[model samples]
Target: MLCSCGSRPDRTGARRLVTPLDERIAALLLAEHAFAPATPGFVGVTVELPAALTGRHQLRHGFLSPRSPGTAALSGPPSPGLEAGIARMADDLDAATSLVGEVTPGGVRVALEAGLEGGGPLGLTRRWALAATLAPVLAAAFANSPSPEGWRSTRQARHRGLPVLRAVSDPRRAWAAYVLEQPGRGGPGLAGLARHVDALRPPVAARGHLEIDVADRQPRDGWRVVVAVTAVLLDDPRAAAAVEEITAPLAAEPALWERAARDALSDPVLAAAARACFVEAYGTLARHGARRDLRDQVAEFTERYVMRGRCPADDVLDAGAGFRPVPR
Candidate 1:
């Protein structure tokens, strides 16, 4: 049995014993704080907390830094639902899937069903597009898995340079043409939204939610940074413009995503662009009364990487990394 005690009963009063595979994997992930599978698999969790502004730097470094305090999201197990979802999805899939950090089955990256406050659909879509534009730099900043299945430099090497899927350049056209035109599957209204998810490579908008898919699993801190930066960009268009200018040269590069995955901050262009984005985001956060600690953490990330010219991947590689084993 996956869970030895099976003491925790569900709402119906039935014990939920996980699959043996999941039980062992979860143990390693929980105890060792690191576990990688030879095949396509993930250890993930879904938080049910109400959405709020997160301090990404604190979250990332807290898990890594012994001195800093960690966030609730960073210190926990894959929820029962999330763990079961991974097992169910991995079983259902016939082909190798992408999206390593996802808990959704079949690697279908779906956001929790919730709408952004105060923003209409069109405005939300624009922010999603802007988020896609900045992903390459973020990818470089938070590159964690340098090796996936014996591949060097990136866990996502196979999927690199595949163009960020900006689903809708014009929000109106997207709603009418792409979204409405998409055929439905599960049910009514938006049951068919999944068809449009990967219509672009990374998918910009899905069922009215912004889908920002960059960075791999394990470090929620990197994910937090990406989300925070996206929110800041939405509020301050000036920061968005600065990010555009910094990344302009790299956007023109054909192998932009590949370069980010492989070279990370070591590449001069990506390092410079990442620095520019961090600076703009940091300034915007300060102006908006973001927590002092959060701002300081962001500054620390900037100093550690942009200032010194290194990425998390560099540290992993320097320490002699290898593939993590799937628990039996």
Candidate 2:
């Protein structure tokens, strides 16, 4: 969520507002059966709902979640006990502090259950593979962090060039073992998976679900773009093929992030590939009978970003108030 300073629009006031607002939001979501921790940086918080609502309602809840940030989840099987435990944890964390990390200018994460139509372990693996394949382009499209002091773009800029995790491409059992075995969570099992779910960021799979953590704090319109891009890549083989074609060559570039982060669409190759994916995604969405508004939003995002070589971060930078220098 964009942390606005209300009438007191300066930086200091914004910082002051974060703590009080974070605390208040934490309380409110608990009252409403949501789990959230008071975020530590910037003036934002994250409330997580146990289930995915319809698109508009989910966005509404996300808006409420920051106080709420748009840290929403897509559909998944019900997990009443897990939800309750998280809410309890959130309550404990809220009583302790109002600091949540990664509260940058451009920060948002939307997670969808990785389970696919076939409904089994293999289905889950397929879902993970698809998300892994499209992670880079989605990251580029949704890059929104740019420092006001002219420090290029994306707060999590490290994400741009980071190689895909080895586990993403491994066989299904291997992927499950990797996630289940991560030491910090616990000894491998359902309990371990639960502990690590929130800890592990998206494009990650655990306990039979996947989360796409590629987006950032975007304009409301950007949500539609994210949904569209995800649907096309995961559901449409043709679009995924096009995206794979584009990103395959980058596996060996020493500083590939420079192209995705600093240069963005300004890089000719990335631009061409991004546009192709967008076009193919649009067509795929159209044939699948997606809503007219959704199709248009995806098209608009494509033209505005892929074709024009601009991203949400560029708009933020142009606004001047969108960022501050990274703290040392």
Candidate 3:
């Protein structure tokens, strides 16, 4: 049934609703990071951990920075439920910040910060979980910020562009005429309301390479790689032997990304892997009984995980550069 929404609704309850296929493709991104220490290459952990990102930079270069941070929301079935969910989400973000102290005391300081963003799917709980998913990604993307006093940045990330771009076309926005006939953020101007979304924005690149405190207590200049991992639940927790067994291998090979580069150069397996993710994502969308509203969302993530490519949403902010966000 279309329910009250002009379009069909997502049948799965938000929390229990991730598609199995998405979990599978997400496994690959994690595998890359897992492979980092072993294969003589870099392995990355992409999470929304502001502290880790901040700590690494502070220790290394005497400053901190964020690359690009993203925000996401899941719309629930209706208004009442949505409000409750967002309140809970807001509370959680506040709580998560407390963990920041752990890294800060250990020589390198880590600061974890959280904020609210806008434009959710509809329901509050669903949007809350989507927001939860985003937390880790924001952490992972944490990059360069200047010093103890956050720098004055002119850099703008596209996290703003995603919700704003909706101005051009969004069926949900098109349907807003019915929802917001009243006042406040209530009108068909949900498009305008979407404009009010928090848009988890991140700062631009570093002024220069920052320093990190090394074993000698000396400052070194270099960049830490941010690895984005997905689909942790897909591989039986242990079957991710591919990712699990890589730390040493990556260090051994030292240049394994060259193989990833080769995938673009000639390896059909790369495309095959990406194609498989798209197919699986579409299947997951269909299986979840969402054949339309979820298409763009799923496609964007698939590109991020499978192709190591930028999504249209991400492109709106930084073209291809801003994946990590560190608070300036």
Clashing pairs in 2: 39-99, 39-100, 40-99, 40-100, 65-68, 66-69, 114-210, 145-154
Reference-based TM-score of each model: 0.52, 0.58, 0.23
Could you say which candidate leads in TM-score? 2
- At residue 31, give the lDDT of candidate 2: 30
Model 2 CA lDDT for position 188: 36
Compute the lDDT of residue 325 as modeled in candidate 1.
Answer: 28
Point out where model 2 deviates above 4 Å: 1-127, 149-155, 158-161, 165-193, 257-259, 324-328
Candidate 1: residue pairs that collide: 184-192
Cα-based lDDT at residue 224, candidate 2: 44
Error of 1 at 289 (Å): 1.8
Query: CA lDDT, every prediction?
Result: 0.46, 0.49, 0.25
Candidates by lDDT, descending order: 2, 1, 3
Model 2 TM-score, all chains together:
0.58
Residue-wise C-alpha lDDT for candidate 2, range 1-328, written one tens digit per residue: 1122334346555523322223233223223321121111111123233222233322211232222244432222222222222233334333322233222223434344444434323244444554564566666677776676543455446555455542233345444444434436432333333445446553444333344566666665354466557655654545555655665565554554545666566667656667777888889878778667778878888888778977787787777876756434
Of candidates 3 and 2, the better by TM-score: 2
Query: What digit string (tens of lDDT, one per residue) describes model 1 on residues 23-116?
Result: 2343332222111111111123222111122343232111111112321122222222222333332332211112123322111132311223
Task: Give the range where candidate 1 is weakest over 10 consecutive residues by summed lDDT.
Answer: 33-42
